[model samples]
Target chain A: MKPFGRVVICGVGLIGGSFALALKARGLVREVVGIGRTTASLERARELGVIDRFATDWATALDGAELVLLAMPVGQMLGVMQAMAPHLGPDTLVTDAGSTKRDVIEAIYSNLKSHLEQVVPAHPIAGAEKSGPDAARADLYAGRKVVITPLSENRPEAVARVREAWAATGASLHDMSPQEHDRVFAAVSHLPHLLAFALVHEIAGRANAEQLFGFAAGGFRDFTRIASSHPEMWRDISVANRHALLAELDTYITELAWIRALLSQGDGDSLLKLFSEARDAREAWLAGRFDA
Target chain B: MKPFGRVVICGVGLIGGSFALALKARGLVREVVGIGRTTASLERARELGVIDRFATDWATALDGAELVLLAMPVGQMLGVMQAMAPHLGPDTLVTDAGSTKRDVIEAIYSNLKSHLEQVVPAHPIAGAEKSGPDAARADLYAGRKVVITPLSENRPEAVARVREAWAATGASLHDMSPQEHDRVFAAVSHLPHLLAFALVHEIAGRANAEQLFGFAAGGFRDFTRIASSHPEMWRDISVANRHALLAELDTYITELAWIRALLSQGDGDSLLKLFSEARDAREAWLAGRFDA
Candidate 1:
């Protein structure tokens, strides 16, 4: 496979830096140009070997690049796409690491239609609570799932290129319509984050939460670890994927209501049975009997 | 400190096996006599070095033991206590690893009131999802908190002996009323587990959950890890700690309603600010400022 020359990765934070390292490690890309809002991070990316060079200007990095990765926050991706529009080469393949797809895909279509044919809106289901280049690791995407949301009018070549790039990082790629991707992730990823955030906020607001946390065991720690993630990014995710998020929230609330009714009516048997089934399902999944 | 002549650990599962391992590691017990309902697990415990000897009969294990550790499920602890009362020595230091102190204390007071003074209901706030003897680790209690709920009528010597035993296992001991312990843990531990179970149940009930899980990221996996825990144990927890769990659930529902209102009204700014503060507080806690 011929290596992609002059690849530009905007927003050289954790996802971007890790992607850059993965690309470099697999020899899929050569001469990676990093761009970020902060000079320190770009310098860190260079020092961390995620990029061969750093650029403050998006246009400078995008010029003549065969691959351009928009790794910025979901809210800022639109302006970023517009900023690099003039510099995008005719055949330059662009993709995003945004959690939500419909909005980003719309922004890309609206902002850079000429290059839209060469763009694929994709999300690599990989990350940690930690962020920035310092938290970046080459194996971040290993054994992870990456979803590519392709439009009916999207160039098949562009979609294939994006799939090949993610495959090089040892990720299994799947394709979905933009709407389906948002709706599915809204249930699994976005809603769960909202629930975690809401739970933490609720508990933290309690008068005795500080004291309660003292006795918190492993379960509490594991359940709330993602609650400690970057808020700005999650807030944007919740809003950007609001429709699907709200739908998922409705389902969660319904389930909670049933539990509350059981508890209120002292229906111990049903509550116990509900908890037992869910536990069995999850245990079987963990034990490899069922797919996770 | 002199080693306990013989320590009988009831229910040789995760906590029981862990307790047995810690005692053996510190040379705090001359012999660990494990009693389990299942003969196979007893054999496994002996093989794993979690116990020096094992039997399916609680009476056999409690016969000559100086310390009798009630490490059974909360719901089963009462029946086990009653079953072992025939063989409990007058001077035996009785303690428990039950999470709900109030229930365990009641069980002791009701089932073995004649020797209730020798019982000290304790809850070790450390555990892992991986259950059974195989999951037992000697250092599991290191740096972990253990709460001892001693009533005014309980013997001082009994409390001291239990405290020393847990401390020898490298756990930090704290004192709390049984009521306080239950209330606090409801918020910190029980509520979180219930929420995780409910969330996963809701998602699994959805038409797209199987497909959705295919794109489930690390956040989903981490948040739901506890969902894979033992169902019988968790069901017992929710049933035994019903009042406290209900109270915590009320608080969570109230806060969730407030959040839903905020979202409905499009108050993203306030929501973001609240989330950011929680994120910062949790990050600081993770950095060890919350260590006692």
Candidate 2:
């Protein structure tokens, strides 16, 4: 296989930086150009050998670039896509590592209409609570799941190249429609994050916050661990996937109300049945981890 | 310090068995007698060295018992108390390791009214997902928090003895009223557990449960981990603390509604603010852990 002669990474952060390192580690890329919002981060990427060099603008960054990975927060995707519209090569492949695909795909369709065939969106289901260039690891995506949500206009070769690029990083490939991707994630990933945030926010705003937190133990710690995530990133996700997320939140509220009624009636036997079903479900999920 | 000669532990599971082990490890108990609803468990507790012997009846178990610890689920506390009332010696200091203090205290007052002076209600804030005699560890309560909700009727010497016993297990002691203890725990511990159980149950009931769980990752795992806890135990805690837990659950529902409105309006700025506040609160809580 021929090497990617020139590749551009727009974020130069964890996912972007790690992808750059993984390609370099495999000798699959000739050059990796870092372009992002902050010069300090690009400079850090350069100094850390995460990229061959840095670019302040897309024109300079994408000039004859064989591939581009838009790995910034989803909120910034539109601006980046619009900026690259005038500079992108006719056949240059573009991909994203956004958490939410439908919204990111919409951003791509609106801004890069003519380049839709070369645009592929993917989500690598791997990350740390920590972010930034320093946290990037070559093995971050190793043995992880990388979901590619391909558009109707996406070129076969372009999608294959994107898949090959991710596969080279040691990730297993999976496919889902953009809508299915968003809906599934909204139910599983996004909803849990929203619930955790709500719980922590509610307790933290209490006048007796200090005293309440003093009694929090392992369960509270694990339940709210995601609450300590980067606020801006999660804010973007919650907003972009708000439609599916809102549906999930509503369903959860209904479930809670049902539990409240049961508790109000002091129906311990019924409550026990619900809790046991949940416990059995969770245990079954654990036991059938990969199969499930 | 005098040893607790003939100490009897009802319901020899994780909390009960570990208490027996912690006491034995410290040479604080001369003989530990195990009693529970099931003969199989009592036999297991004896065989595992969690207890010196096994007794099926409260009458036989309470004979000459210097101290008695009701380490059963809160739902069974009333029945056990009623059975022990006739056999309990006049000076046998009684204490319960129930998660909910108010309900357990009510049971004590109703059945052990004359022994009120000898009964001290305490809660050990340490536990495991696993139960039964096999999960018992000699250091289970080491460096954990044990809160005592001393009844107005409790004698100073009896309260002191209960506190001393818990402290001897290497746990730090705190004091609170029954109402206060139940309220705080409902907000921090019980509510989180209920929310987790509801989430697991909701997803497991869905037609796409297997698919939904297959996509679930770290966040869902941590957020729903407590849903796998003993259903009967959680049922008792939820019912016993239903009053306070209901209030907290209602408060959380209100918070979710507030978030839903923000999302409906696409107010990412407000969402960001809320998320940042939550992140700050979580970080602060972690920093002020012991002090808070």
Candidate 3:
């Protein structure tokens, strides 16, 4: 891949910082600039070599920039896009690492309408419970999945440039429509996160929470591990994809109602069949992932 | 702890096999007799040194048995108790490693009425998704919690014997009433397993399951890891503790509705607060577990 002249990362947290480090590791960028809401965070990212320097304004950050990544939470994407739209270069390739694609795409159309061809929305399927610059790793995206949701107005060359940029991070990239991306993620990713958070919150609010958690073993720990994720980041994701997510949540609640019925009726045979099918499905999924 | 002259294990699977192995590890038993429906399984247990010999009948298995541990699914406890009660030695210490307490206590009362004084019930809080003889580990219970829910008709010495036997396995023992035991586990352990299973089943049944699973990452894996647990075992547990589990499910459904309302109303502030509270509670719970 041809190396870009200069790249700017809007949110130099784990995703953004790691992208910067990964690009540098591949020698794919001549120089990287960090931009964020806080000067201290930008300074920390610069000190950690995640970026060469820090820019406080979009005009300075986008000046002569060849590529830009909006890695902030979805809630901040619209405002950031508005801030950078006037300063965006005519040929700059812009992409985002937001969790939701449809919302980000909408934000792009609403704020960066003139740059629609260059604003390709993507989601890197790599997240940890931890965040911030220090949690960044050069290989965080290695062997992970990155999905690109190109807009209808996007130029082929611009989408190719965005995909190639993610490819430099050693991640396998997949393409889908923004609507499909939001729907699939709302089912697999967003719903699980919300369910996890709810479980922890329910138990935490109980009068016998101490007693309950005292007996919680490995199962509870793994099932609720995502509840420890960065709160604001998840809040942004959940709200940004609210329509698709609400649908998925409704479906899951319906499924839970089915299970509640099975248990209430004392249908052990049906329960066993359901659990067995689930186990087989999950086992096959894991096996397929490994075989891939 | 006093060593038993002969120990009888009914199930000869992970829990029972591990119990036999832990006792042998501490030289707390001179011999362990294996009893099961399948001679093949019993033979495997003997060959694995989980037991000294196999017995086809409960009478022979319980002959001169100083201690007996019924470590089978709660669904099988009643039948096993009925079979063994005929031969249970007057001074024999009887206990179990069932996950649910009230059902096992009911089984004890119904089938082993004459042996009530010697029939103690206990639950070792150590469990793995894996099962069978080969999954048995001598240190399975080491540093794990073991809840002993004594029968109201039991001799204090019998309860001590049950507790000491588990203590010999290196587990820290706690005492709770059988009612409390069922309610607590229904929240912490059983509910998580069912939810995981339900989520996996819901997704696997979808037409786009392959696509959804393909993009699933660490969060999804951890969130649904328990879905791959033993189906029959979990079915038994779910059925055995249906009442408490149903209550938990209803409460959780209500909580999900509240979250749904928040999402539908675009209540980002409330959502953030909820997630932050869950994260803080989980962090504190994890910290307390580590400190303990």
lDDT of each: 0.82, 0.90, 0.92
Estimate TM-scores for all models: 0.95, 0.96, 0.97
Cα lDDT for residue B247, model 2? 95
Q: Which stretches of model 2 miss by more than 4 angstroms?
A: A1-3, A25-27, A289-292
**For every candidate structure, what is the RMSD over all alpha carbons to the true structure, in angstroms?**
2.0, 1.8, 1.8
CAPRI grade, predicted model 2: medium
lDDT of 1 at A118: 88
lDDT of 3 by residue, B8-53 (tens): 9988999999999999998999999999878888888888999999
- Tens-digit lDDT track of model 2 for B138-168: 8999988899999898899998888889998
Q: Could you give the CAPRI-style class of model 3?
A: medium
Question: Candidate 3: where are CA atoms >4 Å away?
Answer: A289-292, B289-292
The top-ranked prediction according to DockQ is 2
Q: How accurate locally is residue A102 in candidate 1, as Cα lDDT from 0 to 100?
A: 91
lDDT of 3 by residue, A160-238 (tens): 9989999999999988898899998998889999999999999999988888998999899999999999999999999
Candidate 1 lDDT, tens digit per residue, A188-279?
Answer: 78877777887777766667666766667678778988888888888777777777777777778889889988877777678777877777
- Quick one: best TM-score, which candidate? 3
lDDT of 1 by residue, B60-179 (tens): 777777888888779898889888888777888888999898888788888888887788889998867778889888888999999989867678988898888988889999999999
